[model samples]
Target: MSADEGTTPSPLKPARPSMTAAMRSSSFLNDHQQYRPPSKPDNHYGIDTVVEDLQASSINSPKQISPFNGIPSPENPPTIVESGLSHEYTHPNCTQPPGLTTDRLIATLFYKSTSPRVSNAVGPSSSPPHTASSPVRASSPTGADAEIPSNLAPSSSFDTFPLEPPTNDTEPLDHIYGSYVSPMCITSFLHLMSTFPLPRGSTNLTSAHRCLKLDAASDHHPQVVELTLAPAPSQDYLSLADLRKHELIYRFEREWNIDVVLRSDTLWRRHPRLVVFDMDSTLITQEVIDLLAATIKDPPDLAARVADITHRAMSGELEFDGAFRARVKLLTGLSADIFNQLRPVLDVTNGVRPLLRALKKLGVKTAVLSGGFLPLTSWLAGELGIDYAHANEVVIDEATGRLTGEVKGRIVGKERKQELLLEIAQKEGIDLEQVVAVGDGANDLLMMESAGLGVAWNAKPMVQMEASARLNGESLLDLLYLFGFTDEEVAILSKET
Candidate 1:
């Protein structure tokens, strides 16, 4: 029955193969029977064979044809398929699906690939041999065909990119001297004034007489008669009591006057080598601890306590050890991070830049022997270009990043300040006679006393009285005169600065 049916064409022809199945079979045959050039000049003839025959020949043959060129060879030339013009190629058996575009390919190469071309230039073997066929990705943002926001981009936008000048006006002003100041100038001026010797003998008495006589004559003048004056003594001759009363009046006027000290250019000509400075209320206008307290969150009262301790210490009412310990205790649990955060807000005193600049020019080996924290003091020293600096370090908790409420190293007290001053002088190979110390508070007495020259700048009554020279109503530039800077030199500095 099957023979008869096959012989007599069936009503339905053999079920036509599905289009997909036919295509698949055709592709398979084409791949298997694909024409290959001869392997060598000896085997140059092309052989036509069916799929089965070609399969048998391929298995038997020791060499294959060159896919690149029509000529056959013993070495098979690699098959390089130009898949597309999209700057990407695909590999066979990459079964992880498709639809990857050029951009994705480039990004994947950048982030994932570590081939020679994509290797970091900063690597140990920086200069790798270049392969022409190896794909090179652009190293700069501009060369990339992608969008990136300005702020989100790296500061160095591109390694090879050109840089433009700053556009804003504030850029230049950022470097000006108004940026930072040192507090040493005033303290030094005040200390100097205190030690200045007064004219001796009855010169003081003669000055008193001149003031009294001037007053008496002014009282009798037609212009003076209209003005009020002490009643003319009823007796023609003056008694010792009258002279004493007159002397007291003259002395009161002299002491109270704002311009009490005379300006003498000669006095400043004598130069001083060593200068010592007080830290708080001297070099810097504000007590660092007090300012630090104010910056603390949620409590304002702590700032007051810090200020009190600072005042007592400066005035010598409390021993430095007791005051410093008490103050540090108040700051226990404070974060070390506060120093960095509050540095920008610290108030640098006025006239510090000019003073420090002048001192530096004079070849004075400047130092800051402060009672403040080392971090703050060191920062100031670096900023001001001071040669030497010694200050106490605040002990900080490594884990919690908080202050331990204790100083880590030596306490820079009155005695320590003096010691540092001597140490610095000895190290610099300078004698004490070549040194000058300046400070505004009682804590600075030891340093001031040790220096050959001591100046007080806007100091307390006690400090002012003890200092050898006092500077009032002048910029710190005047200190240059004390270091032998002439008017011409000062003018040149002012211009250069």
Candidate 2:
């Protein structure tokens, strides 16, 4: 037979009805416009496999059925089938509910439906039967006459799905800052908290033995323990600034080298926009101008006189601006190469390099403000990769290549240091609270007082007494702990380059 003659419709297949009568009616297209055929049936028997896997996991792994696995309680049992065939399963342990089982697995995959039309949407009869697996299956509803699961009956009220376990997303923000007068000792953290008086205005501690809430799972630092202290109901909020007012705090500082660091939890959480430093003794061990005066070629005895003047100025015996001018005058007619000669003698303080590298990784802007001259400060700033440097300009005569004794511009003493800090903070679009100032002299006091956190690094008595914190240790890396950074964090930041 020919190909056309051989082709015939199967006897089992029904012919599609013509739509000519319905098409004649105007509302026929509009009325059935919202009608849609059911989705294609899922041609897999994965549900049986999932049920078997869950059964195996429950039996093989006892740890998987942990009581604290964030399952809901039995007092309000979860609906398993919702097909009116309600059954409750109690574990033999009875201490808690067993973790997800085959029934719960099925419940999770098949949501209960209130509408009869969708009630049996995914049941056995909805698709072709599977011969490979013998899993329990419900019958699908057939047209308006077909029955839905009785348990899936419509209710006036229904519970939404159980809420997911609380996450660690808010963990970092939930931390409480702790402050200590001295460097935190990891070994003595818990001991200190227990022995010391509760942080200021802890009126709630009357009933409780401890004032601070120590988080057992805190992972930041073992030495710098994370804690939370609720504000006293009747008293004003306490801050690190108010630390000195309490006699107990003073005793802690004097006796144990410990003082409460207030609101320390918030420090260094966000990267600061600017960090200002006093260049002389802060960045380097020796004062730059004093070093410059010592290295001047033309002056032999000038170093001694200038050294004495510098000591007096740094000790606050002489005013910085006048004393600086006097010391600069002693270098008059001296070759400008004095800075180059002192360059080899310059000693960067311990921990300066690592700290600066870490700060650079964090994208913090660093600058040095000094009463010393620019030639030395500029060179040091370049070596340290400092973003900005400001200092006094020593006028040099082009013919002699020597100092003329007259300053070319404004002096960068205490007042100017404060001004530069303010200008840098403003230019960088950061608040004063985001700025950290470090110094080691009486002249650095003004700038220190103006910054958000002032660190007196091996400073004179006056600077130490007034600054926010004092670091008597030789290492500058200790500053990391003050900002709530652990050793691990510093190490991670170190490798970024």
Looking at model 1, which ten-residue stretch has the lowest summed lDDT?
Answer: 103-112
Which residue pairs collide in model 2, if any? Answer: 82-151, 83-151, 84-151, 177-264, 177-265, 179-260, 179-261, 180-261, 181-259, 186-223
Model 1 CA lDDT for position 192: 31
lDDT of 1 by residue, 1-497 (tens): 67877695549668875667545653564478667544434333345444334544433455776565455333543344566534323332122235621110000000001111122222122232223422233242233233322211222223421334222111111122111111122222233323322332211110100110011222221100001111222223543224223443223212221112221222222556666676666677777888777766656688877876676566555788778878888888988988877677666666677677766766777888888887888888888788787888888999999998988767888788888888898988888877877676667778887886666655654565555544442244444444444445655655535
Candidate 2, residues 311-414, lDDT tens digits: the string is 66776668988998888788788788877888888899988988899889888899999888888889999999999999999899999999988887788888
RMSD of each: 37.0, 31.0
Worst 10 residues of 2 by lDDT: 103-112
The residue-level lDDT of candidate 1 at 145 comes to 34
TM-score of each prediction: 0.47, 0.54
The CA root-mean-square deviation of candidate 1, after full C-alpha superposition on the true structure, stands at: 37.0
Candidate 2 stretches with Cα past 4 Å from truth are: 1-202, 205-242, 245-251, 257-270, 296-301
